[model samples]
Target chain A: MLKDFFRTFSSMIELEFRRLKHDRTEIYSRAVQPILWLAVYGPIMGSIRAIPTGNIPYTDFITPGVLIQSTTFISIFYGLTIVWERESGILKKLLVTPAPRYATVIGRAMASGIRAIFQTFIIILVALIIGVKFILNPFYFVLALVIIFFSSGGFAAISILVASFMKTRERFMGIGQALTMPLFFASNALYPVTMMPKALQYFATINPMSYVVDAVRSLIISGDLTNLWLDIVAIAIFNIIMFTLASVNFKKIIE
Target chain B: MEKAVDVRDVVKIFNKNFRALDGVSLEIESGSIFALLGPNGAGKTTLMRILTTQIGPSSGHAYVFGLDTVKEGSQVRKLISYVPQEMSVWTDISGYENLLIYSKIYGIPKEERNNIINGVLESMGLHDVSNRLVKTYSGGMIRRLEIACALLVRPKILFLDEPTIGLDPSARKVVWEKLKMFKKDYGTTIFFNTHYMDEAEIYSDLIAIINRGKIVTIGTSEELKHSVGGEILHFILSENGLHEDVLRELEGIEGIKDVVVSNSDVTFVVNDAEMILPHIMTFFNKKNIFVRRVSITKPTLDDVFLKYAGTRIDVSGRLSEVTHVRRMIRRG
Candidate 1:
């Protein structure tokens, strides 16, 4: 049974890989966004002020946080791939096949995380050239990967939840942009959470990006642990809750 | 005999309150080439979609190759390959790549996919067009590719919607030959939908004519042609006054049901054109009504369609559509 599940999962992943060959949008947006945030935004901040990020170079402190942000943003549109398929009659094609929907979901999530990993590497390479306080510690590096998988997948589930109800391409795009941009803006996108106003801080605590950004912020920005477990726990809870919701919605629409 | 497709009281209503299909029922015998003929707003596509398991019925049930479309949806889908009417080819990809993607999705073994793809492509004479992006392909090549995609699965039943919509005369002949080959080689039951009467009449073993979301008529072309019974007498009138008087007398004849007198001539509906046509012509000649043109033709399926739908069934007949077909593959 486990082997069967793995085969289905891998096939689903392979399906996405096939789609990626034709999907050119990822080459531009996923790879370029974090590099600009790091090489452009990070350097401007480090040169301008002492910054709130301890004494370390601002680029080093901000690199992982930006990487996580980009992953979440990119992954949240995993459902858009479905929307395109549904619009193109490819969804009909997929539904007719014997492959399970859960495998489709998990496989899509796998694809999203892998793409994010590649994007994160690009940003890291750009940061290294720009003299950011880069971390070579394998433990923290692995931790960064875990954070991306959890947060990116959770965001993708949310995307799937919205995409399930959409009937048109415009509606899909509207929902995708609506969820992604707000989460980015509400989190500690450009500043430390400690610097936020009281109401903003209260709102930031519940936002998912707050947890994801905080986890990456702790590992790479502060070079120390502070409430990392809370982010991990919240992300795990979000993953389960949203994944269940997405799976249910996905089944409903297809049926 | 076992049936390849059995549908009873299938219905579908869109969320926007459009009643696409209203309780459609049909049975297609195994190995028969069945043609579904309907006007633009008719429910043919909806019925096809439900049978293919791409959309579920609002009510009632359907089965393909004995597998229930709803309960055994995966199995039903496994048995059917739908070639939708639209230009569904991948514009940015080669025809070969498109076939490869669909083959993998259908879970065809690698060797078989290659063999089928090569065979189907070569049969369609599309092996030369397989390398270029589909955007550069002509209308006929694109349609051939659509058929190629559907055939990759070696399905027991093939559903083709407007499969010959854009083909030229010669390409259409090539397509018909391939369809005949497909059935002869695979014993595949073809459930085809077309507005082109020539395509349907010349190719199908059985024909069902639908109008206004209902199947008003179903039979072979010969059966439909003889359904209203008897023969048809036609007269083309010029802007001259000689032929009208005799046609007026024939309008009052006992067995005639309809008379259309336009300009200088009259058209008569009769129980037997052989019985009434010569009498009318003789009367017109004796009375000096000047018969310009007269012909005896049997009632056609086109006449039956016009009789029921109040319109002609031309593949290129322009539709100022009250509702567009669902913007899906082959307009859904």
Candidate 2:
């Protein structure tokens, strides 16, 4: 039974990669936004000294937030493809297989995580080209990549949960649009929580995206382990909770 | 007979008002080709979905190989594959990749997936187009590709909903030949729905006619025709202005069970058409009605469907659907 899960899971990931071969535009399209912000917005905001930055360059401070933004944006639309497969009857075909239901959820969530890494690489390359530099350690970079993957997984789980209820692609897109900006701005992606109002600070404190950015920023900007443990613990807990919700809802939809 | 599928009083209600399958019950023998006949909204697809474990019955039970569909869904799913009505292929992927994806999904050993995919493609006569993206395939090739994908698992029972809905005659023939080969080679029980009356009559070992979410009748082609119990006689009057009168006289003839007149044509049913034909001719003569043409034929599956559904199986005729069919073909 366990072997079947892995086999099916790997195949689901393989299928996603094969599909990605045809969607070359997706890479450019998702990368364009973050690259623009890094080269354009980051420099403009840094020169104006618009926000508080304690000795750290504003560009460097915003780099990790932009990376998290790019990764989450790419991951959150994973459910749109699920709804597309449902329309194309691919989901029905896969549902009848011996593959376990949890494998599908994990496989698709993992695929989004994998895809988000590509976006991460793009954002990082663009950040470097634009003269944004930070402390780099191979070990910490690997650890930061893991955090990004888990963060992507958590967002994917939320997308799948939304899709289980919104089976139609159009309606799912409608909800994704309504939720994307709120989730981004409410977090510490662009502005630090200290810069937000009291009410906004409460939301940013609990937002999962904030922890992801915090962990990534600590690894890259300060190489500090001071709050690293809390970020990892919070994101891991978020992953567990969101994946459980996604699996339960996915099984219900297929059933 | 070994029953491959057994459905007992299955009911499916949508939105608490629309009854999709109303107490449908049927038993299909193993290794048999069973054709389900129904109109557009007759619930045939809904019933097939339940048997294939895609959905559950509201108030009754369905069994495949004696396993409860709702309770042992995963086990039942392992034994079946479905070809839904829509074009299910991934248009952007090559036929080879499409089969490969399913092979992996079915968990064929990684090493053997290639060999299995190649063999199925060859068997379906799709090796020539295997390298081309499915978007470039014809409607016929797409249908055959779907069958090949389903065969990757070598399922014991295959369920197809309208397996040949909008195909041209040649394409329809190709699909049927491939299906026949599959059934013969592996003893896979083939069950499908089709809009063509002749298709059901020519290919299926048994047929079930469904109407308004109920199984109206179930039997072999010959059995269904015989069940209606008579031969049909048709007479075309030569614009003699006496079609109504001739129909009246023909109805009164002894042994002529029933008569119907439409557009200068008269049709009637009789236990023995040979014995009744001479009288029908004489009545037209006595009334001096010119008989333009007359023919006698055994009851057809269309007649059987007409008897049960109160309408011709292809009541709108295939001509009217040519444009719509062309659009689906173009979509491929």
RMSD after CA superposition, every candidate: 6.0, 5.4
lDDT of 1 by residue, B109-222 (tens): 767878888988987779988987766777678778888888887788898877776566788888889889989999999998877788889999999998867788899887
How close is every model to the real structure, measured as TM-score?
A: 0.79, 0.87
Candidate 1 ranges beyond 4 A from true positions: A1-12, A19-26, A47-51, A77-81, A105-110, A137-153, A198-206, A214-237, A251-255, B15-18, B85-92, B165-173, B233-296, B313-332
**Candidate 1 colliding pairs:** B86-B330, B242-B289
Provide the lDDT at B18 for model 2: 95
| lDDT (Cα, tens digit) per residue for candidate 1, span A114-147 | 6676667777777778776655677887897778
Clashes of each: 2, 0
Question: For candidate 2, what is the interface RMSD?
Answer: 2.9
Report the lDDT tens digits of candidate 2 across residue range A1-255.
Answer: 898888887887777677677665787798988888788888898899988867778888889998998889878888887766665556777777778877878788878887888788888888888787777699899899988977898898889888888977779989888778888889887878898999999989889999998899889876767989999899989988988898888855543
DockQ of 2: 0.42
Candidate of highest DockQ? 2
Q: Which ten residues in a row have the lowest lDDT in candidate 1 chain A?
A: A88-97
